[model samples]
Target: MITFAVLFIAAFCAGVQNALAGGGSFLTFPALMLTGLDARAANITSTVALFPGQITTGFAGRKNISDLPQLSFKALFIISLIGGVLGAILLLITPVSVFEFLVPWLVLFATLVFLWGSFFRKIHENPKPLGPLKAIMAQFAISIYGGYFGGGIGILMLAALTIAGLDVRTAGATKNVLGGVMNASAVLIFLFSSDVAWTQVMVASIASIAGGQVGAYALKRVNEKRLRICIIILGFGLAIGLFLKAHGS
Candidate 1:
């Protein structure tokens, strides 16, 4: 009963944070890991459970989402799909010890990229000739990282989208959609091969959707910049902690 209550609160926070800034895993994953769960299991569980929050956020923002300039969902899906498949395969084949060592560096890099991401948005406001391709490449590359470690992926995706000439809100939306793809793929793979706590997923998913609907709707009335900044700080601070923990363990 306590775990259910805790997960419900966490999912609500995650849904709101994800809708505004795209880094809800900063809350969910660590919370799961703290429960004596193994990292792989926790990663899969967090992604699967929080996925509905993202979907709800996406759907709630349909007015804004549908109005965004021509994005090739087909093309985006292809890159995300291929990347997710390869990432899952790589996860199965790779050694945990090796990935364990690399996790700190990955988190640290994502933090720095997000910190200095203003340059990418301001200077590269418009994509050069092959901008869309670059965006796809960025998403493809990050999908592997998301699959492998599942931390700070929102920061990575937002940074990549900035580099590809997207404003923050658009980048946030695109990041959410891509995340849904990577997570859905990863979840399917995990379901087929591993034991998943479906009860947990159900609990978290319902909580997340309710929270996400509220959060996405609030975007219409709230101060977005302040909210986004709060999310970024939470994300970066958590990333730093994850980095330290990665090396500590």
Candidate 2:
């Protein structure tokens, strides 16, 4: 009962976070790892479970989306699709233990990226306009990282979106949509070879969806600076926790 409650509470909180600032994995991933699943299995299962959360975000934002920045959206979506697929493929091919060492650093980097997102944008950029070819390649590359282990893909995506010239809402929407695509592709990629906690994922997903609706409504009422600070605080905490878990364990 405690385990079930933990999963539900985590999912609900993560759903709200994902809806507001993005990074549902911050909660769900650790929760899964703490379960009996091995690191690889936990990662794969977590990616697979992102679908429902993405769906919730998409639906909540549906009405506000009048036009999808067609050219850019297609460019980004295609790129993300290819990247996500590749990430999944890489996971299927790579050995699990080989990745265990990388998680801590990746999480740390993602944490820093989120904590200093605005600064990262102010100081530097992706160098070019990121045409179709570049867009596809970039997303594909990020997807590989995301599929292999998505600790802070949201932070990475947001940074990328700035370069893509997408506004905050559009970028968030695009990220959610592309993220869903990545998770879906990863699901196919790991279906046969990996262990998936379907029962736990289903329950968590439900709670996340319910909480997401509430989040969509809440995003409008909240102040952006306060929210960003709160998210950064959580991101920092998650980063430290991951560091300890990776090193201490």
Candidate 3:
């Protein structure tokens, strides 16, 4: 009961974070690890558990979604699906020890990426949009990463989309949709994996869905800058804790 309660709270917060800025895995992944799963198993379970909430959040912001001039949304969607499948395959084949060793570094890298995207990246007054080839390439790489680990894919996509000429609002909405699309492919693969913690997945998924609704509703009303700062701090703190844990072990 305590485990379920903890997972529910963590997943709920993750859902809200994901809807607002896109680093929910930072929460769910660690929470699962604390529940006694190994790093790879935790990651797989986190991806599967959070997927439904992602869809809900994306759908709630569908109105702001738009296609890039360089690439159609359909084209990007297909790329995400293919790349996600490939990444998932790679993850499944990765040894547990290797993944555990990589987890801390991955979290750190993702935190830095999110920090840069959230605060440091400057939008030019007359930004040049990425060409079709460049946009496609970027999206494919991000999709693969999203499938494999998905720490900061949301901000990564937002940066890519904004560079491709969408406004912040549009990029955010599109990012939400594409994030779900890529993860949908991963979830399909993870559903069959022996690593998934279905009991935790069930509890987390329900809590996350409820939290997504709250987050979607708060998207406009909440102070995003403040929320993003909180996420950044949490991310960095988690990264440090994970590194220490890894070193001690």
Candidate 4:
């Protein structure tokens, strides 16, 4: 009962974080790991568990989505799918020990990226348009990372879209949609794998979906800045915890 409750609460906050910013995995991944799953399995399970929320948020924001002039949504989706597939394959083959060791660093890196996102967005507020090739390659790279870890991919995508000439509003909506696409691609691969905890996935999925709705409605009342700061702190704390776990074992 306690485990389920914790998973539900973690996923609820994760959904809130994803909806408000983009660090849901910082909560969900560690929460799963705490349930005695190995790092790789936890990561994959978290990906699967949180996927429905991504789809829900994406569809909710679909009408606001705009196409990038340099890269159409269809092209971007294709590139992201291919990248996500490759990344999932790579993750599947990675040794459990190696993945465990990498988790802390990955969380730390993603946290830093999340912290720098607003500054980067400010810098790219009026960026010169990216070339088509550059934009495609960038999106593909981001998609690969998204499939691999997926903590802060939304912010990364938003920054890329902004630099590629999309306005902030359109870029945010595009990020939401593309995030869902890449995650869906990865989730399909994970579904065939044996690493998932289906019960946990189901619980977290329902909780996250409900939480996403709550997050959307709470936007007016919640202080985003404080929420972001809390997420950042949690990310660092989780990274430290994982690092110790990796070293102690």
TM-scores for every predicted model: 0.82, 0.80, 0.83, 0.78
lDDT by residue for model 4 (88-147), tens: 777887655655566677667756755665344586466468789998988998888788
Write candidate 3's Cα lDDT for 113-156 as tens digits.
65776677785645467899999999998898788888766656
Which candidate tops TM-score? 3
Residue 17 local lDDT, model 4: 64
Worst 10 residues of 2 by lDDT: 63-72
Q: Which pairs in model 2 have colliding backbones?
A: 83-140, 87-144
- Compared with the true structure, the alpha-carbon lDDT of candidate 4 equals 0.74
**Candidate 1 has what TM-score?**
0.82
lDDT of 2 by residue, 1-249 (tens): 677688788888877777665667768877776666777777777777666877777676765432233345666566667777887888877785555567556656655655555444565554454355555665676777777776667656654554455645555556666776677777777776648888777877887887777777776566666765665675666667666766765
Q: Tell me each candidate's RMSD, in Å, in order.
A: 3.2, 3.6, 3.1, 3.9
Sum up the clashes in candidate 2.
2
Compute the lDDT of residue 47 as modeled in candidate 3: 93
**3 versus 4: better lDDT goes to:** 3
Highest lDDT model number? 3
Cα lDDT computed for each candidate against the true fold: 0.68, 0.67, 0.80, 0.74
What are the clashing pairs of model 4? none
